[model samples]
Target: MMFMKSIFALAAFATAVYAQSVTIAAPVEGTSVTAGQNFTVDIARPNTLSPSQEVAVVIGLVSCSEAPFNGNCASFDVSQIFGTILYNGPYTPTLHNGPSPDFIDFYQNFTLTVPSWFTPGSASLNVAHVSLIGAGPFPDLEVKNITLNVVAA
Candidate 1:
């Protein structure tokens, strides 16, 4: 009976440790922008959640739809930005062990610096997807397919 009880306890603990999730809320669908301006993306935890959380975002640049049909679609260079946030409560310097409240907010901003030789037209800002790892007492999570459009200067 003692061994059986210990197995059950371990299972329950595993479930609790894998219950957290993260979400990306905005820059909204179909957002538009002009060159030389800043674009914003927002991240949050669902209202149904009740635990402190942490996440990192990576941003990248890709070719616009109007690129020549034969143009190297995969040739575009990629860049990354890093950010972290504490949700729905006061910020804590330490990871985990923070108080929980209603929602946690994070943002990623991208701006285009047009090269003097480039022409003015439309391009795409791809949010290379969100990755949630190292979650404590929470499920590992991910959000994908977020993107925006910009008109070159």
Candidate 2:
């Protein structure tokens, strides 16, 4: 019974250590912009993981109707988006007070030129974050979506 208890404890600890998430820190929800203009998207996450456990983020801006639209990107298509993979690298962690004063958050910014072909209307900015573990066959992924208003430049 004692050995079983130890195993459970270890499992819980592992789960907590692997808990991770990603958030859109800029061009906040409902933000308005113009097509053919350069815009910056800031992606943020908690700076609570070890250096070996690095993260990579891929950003894509698409029409709201084109996204999974279910608040999940389990089936997102990189080819169906308007903006390019504006960012595809590790998140640059910085020290800043976050939602809770108890902790700090870091972010990486990506600049994207809103495609000139984009129509004047609403759109969705989607991101897929892959948490790369020091040693693992499969990386964990977290997806997020934010809405933006676009107008002709």
Collision count for each candidate, in order: 4, 0
Q: Flag regions of model 2 displaced more than 4 Å.
A: 1-19, 49-52, 65-84, 99-101, 134-138
| Candidate 1 per-residue lDDT over residues 1-153, each given as its tens digit | 999999997886555434333334455645665545545544433332334344444443333443441233333433332111112222112222214554333333333343333333333333333233333543343333333454565
| Candidate 1 weakest lDDT stretch, 10 residues | 82-91
TM-score, one value per model = 0.42, 0.69
Q: Model 1, residue 45: displacement in angstroms?
A: 2.1
Per-residue accuracy of model 2 over 114-144 as CA lDDT, tens digit each: 8887766667777888776433434667677
lDDT of every predicted structure (CA atoms): 0.39, 0.69
Maximum-lDDT candidate = 2
